[model samples]
Target: MTETAVEQFTEHQRKRGKRVSVVSPLDAPFFETERGSLILGDCLQTLKSLPANSVDLFVTSPPYDGQPKYGNGEKYERDWYRDFFMAVSAEILRTLKPHGSFVLNYRSKRRGAERGVLQYEMIFWLREQGFLFCEDFIWGKPSPPPGKFNRFLKDAVEYCFQFSKTNDWQFFPENCLSPARWDAKDRERRKKLAHNYVRANAPSGQGRKRVQAGPDMVRPSTLLHLEPEFSPNPVKHPARFPVELPSFFIKLLTQPGQLVVDPFGGTGTTGLAAERLDRRWLLVEIDPTYASIVPTRFENGR
Candidate 1:
C-alpha cells in the first residue's frame, strides 16, 4: 500500500465505529464475561488500520506457503509465500509496542530429497528489522500423524520463534515451576548429611530446586507437546497449532488486560486462548466466511 493509502485507511478505521465488528454494547450476554471481542475481515486491512505500537504481544501461525487455507478454501502456491510472509511480518512489527514480543509458529519446508536444517532465515529477517532475538523452541508432537512410507517420519515438529521489540521483555518463571519432591536418591543422600545441616533444611523430607533469577532463569521450552482437539468445522485447515501453543506463550509473555494480536487468526484459537487468560485481543481474518465463523464458535462453543 502507498503512503496515501495507509494514511487514508488509518483515518477510516478511527471512524469505523462499533458497527465494523459485531460488538454489541447493550447486549448483556456479550459482556457477561470480560473476554475480548473478535472481528471479521481481511487481516492485512485490519492490521494496517491498527494504531502503531498498540499491541503488547503478537503470536500466530500464519498459513504455510502453498498450503491449504483454514476456514477459507483457497490454496497458497509455494512461489508466492516468501513475499507474502515479508509483507505480513513487517506489518506485525509495526503494530507491536517497543516492549512487546511476537511468537511465530512455522514449519520448515521439505523441498528436496535431502533432509534440511531447521529454517532460521526468518528469525534473521525478524532480528534485522530491530526485533531482538529472544529464543527458538522446537514444539515436538509426541504422537504425530503418519506420512508416506517412502520417507522418514513426517516432520513431527514446528519452530516457535520468539522475538522481542526491546531488550527487556516480560517473562514470569515462578508461574511454571514443578513442586519439589523427595525422590529415593534424595532420601538416601539425606541420611549421610551432618545432623544439624539435615535438621534445619530437611523438615519436609524434600529437596527444593534452587530458584535463580536472570535471563537463563527457567525459560519455557520451545518443544511443546499438546494433544490436538477435534474441531466441528467440516473443512479443517491442514496444519493448525494447538490452543495450548498460544495459552502457554500468553501466560509467559503478557499480563491480564494486555492486548494480544494475531494477524493470521484462523479459527480464533489465539483469541480463544486470550479470552481464557483474561487478556484483550484483536484478530484479523481476510476470508469473510472464516471471519464469520470465529465469533460463532466462541458464542456457541462445542
Candidate 2:
C-alpha cells in the first residue's frame, strides 16, 4: 500500500527462487497521473507479495492456450491449458478484496458446430474460488468483417464475465450510460416503429438548454457498435481490448483511488483506462520488451 513496497523490485525465476538484481529505473512508466503505479514482471511472483484482500478490483484477461500467439515468442501448448488457467485463477482469488470484483474478458472459438469449453469451465472454477457470478455482457465488435469461414458470417464479440467475492459489490449504473438521452417524441416514434416496444421519455429541463434525460433505451441484452482501434502494443501483443472496455468496468465496479490490477498488461490498455478514470493500477507483463514500452503508451490516453 505504501510507495516503499513498490519501489523495491525483486526477480525470481522458477528454477531458482533466489532474488536477483534490483529493477532499473528505465523499467518504470512515468507516473504522470497520481491515480496509480505500474509494475512490470511475472505476475505470479509479483502478486504473491501484495497484501491479501488489499486490491479493490481485478480486471484482466489471461492468455488462453489455443489463441493466436501474443508475440511473446512463446507458444502455450493446448495439452496443459486447463492447468494454466487454474494456476492463474488461484492467484487472482488470493489478491481480490473480500467485496471486490474480478472481471475476465475472453473470446470463445468454434470447433466445428460447437463452442470452446473455456467459458463454461471458467465460470465454474471462478465460482468455486468464492466469487459470486454476475451476468455476462457481450462486447460486440461490429466492424472489421469476419474471416471467410465456411458457414457463418462470424461476427465475433468479447465476453465480459463479471464476478465478485462478496454480495456487497460496487457498480454505478450512472457511469455506464450514454450521455445523450432520447426525447418524448423520439421515444414515441421508436415505440410506434416497433409495436410492443417501450421507450422511456427523456427528462425535461429549464432554460434554452435541453436537460438530457429519459433512462437510456434499456441497454439491449447484447452490446454492439464499436469502432476498431489497433490493439495497444509496444511489443505488439496479439489480442487487446479497447480502452472503452476498461472504462465500462472501472466506472461500474470501482470508485476513484481504488486499485486495479492487470496481470497480463499488454501494451498497458488497462493501466491507461485506470489512469483516465483516476483509479490506482498495477500492471504485470512478463516480456521485457513490452515492459519497456509501458511509459511511451501514456503519450496517448482515453
Candidate 3:
C-alpha cells in the first residue's frame, strides 16, 4: 500500500523530534500536537467517522455561498450551498454532545441590489432541526474594508450564531468577562448607593450599615469589538478569521479539557485558539494547500 500524504507528513514531523501520531482509521492526521489534530480531507466524511455525542463544541466559519475565491473558480449556487451545509449540520447535530454548543460564524454577501437571506434561512432551518437557538454575537470589525455602495452601509459586522442540542448546554459566562472601568470614587459612590437601597428595603432591624460594590469584571456584551489580523496577507488562506474570534467562544462555552471541533478549519485558527485555551481540538480542511500551511502556522506561533 502506498503511504498516504498525511502518513508521510507525520513521519517527517516525527523525524524532527515532534511527538506526533496518525491514530485515526480513516486517514492519518496531517499534523498532531499534544492537544489537537489537523486532518486533511472532506469535513463531512471526517465528521461521519466520529461517534455520535462526542464533540463538546463545534465552531467554524464555512466557505460562503457563491464565493469563487474560496471555491476553485466556480461559484456555489444557493441550492448547492444549502444542501451542503444542511448535510454538514446534520452530522454536527448527531455528533455534538447533549450539553455542547455549536457556534457558526457566517456572513451573507450582497448581489448587485439585493442582500442574501441564506444566513437567516439557515438559522430557521437549524432551529427546525431541533437545535436550540441560544444566542447571537455580533463580531464588530474595528477596521473593515473600505467600500462605496449605492444602497448599503459598509460591512463591519458578522454573525456568530450559537446553538445547542439541548437546553442544558454548558456555558461559563464568568470565564469571558470584560474588565470593568470603575475607579475608586466610582466604586465608593456605587457602594453607598447600594447600601442606601438595601437599608430602605430591608426589615426594621435587619439592614446592614454597608454593602460592597459590584464585581471588578462584568459580563461581556453580545457585540464583540475585535480587529482582524492587521497584515493584509497574514496567511495563505484567503478568508481567515481573527484568532480572537474563536478564543472568545472557547473561553465562554468550554472548560480546560473539553473537545472542540472545527469542520471547516481554515488555516487552523480554531485549532490554535483551542490549544492556547488548553482544550483538545480537531480541525478538518478539504483543501490540501490550505491544510499544508496549518503546520507552519502552528510552528511559527500563529
**Which candidate leads in TM-score?**
3
Roughly what TM-score does model 1 have, to 2 decimal places? 0.72
lDDT of 2: 0.68
RMSD values, in order shown: 9.1, 8.8, 4.2
Candidate 3 per-residue lDDT over residues 37-153, each given as its tens digit:
988778899999999999999999988877888646757667765788889999999999999999999888897799888889989999988899999999999898788987799
For residues 1-302, write the lDDT of model 2, one tens digit per residue. 12332332222221235334445334553233466666655677777777878888888877765665765455554444456666776777787888688888876567687667767777887788777898687887768544787776765677888888778877776666664457777756655454444445546633232333445444433363565556544456666678888877888889888999888886678989998888999887766555545555664453
32-55 in candidate 1: lDDT tens per residue?
Answer: 235565444556666777788888
Task: Candidate 1: list runs displaced more than 4 Å.
Answer: 1-34, 69-81, 115-118, 179-182, 185-220, 300-302
The best candidate in terms of lDDT: 3
Give the alpha-carbon lDDT of every model.
0.66, 0.68, 0.84
Q: In candidate 3, where is summed lDDT lowest over 10 consecutive residues?
A: 1-10
Candidate 3 global Cα RMSD: 4.2
- On a 0 to 100 scale, what is the lDDT of residue 84 in model 1? 70
Query: Clashes per prediction?
Result: 5, 3, 0
Q: lDDT-based ranking, best first?
A: 3, 2, 1
Query: Against the true structure, what is each candidate's TM-score?
Result: 0.72, 0.75, 0.85
Instruction: Enumerate residue pairs that collide in model 2.
Output: 202-213, 203-213, 203-214
Clashing residue pairs, candidate 1?
42-286, 66-76, 137-222, 138-222, 138-223
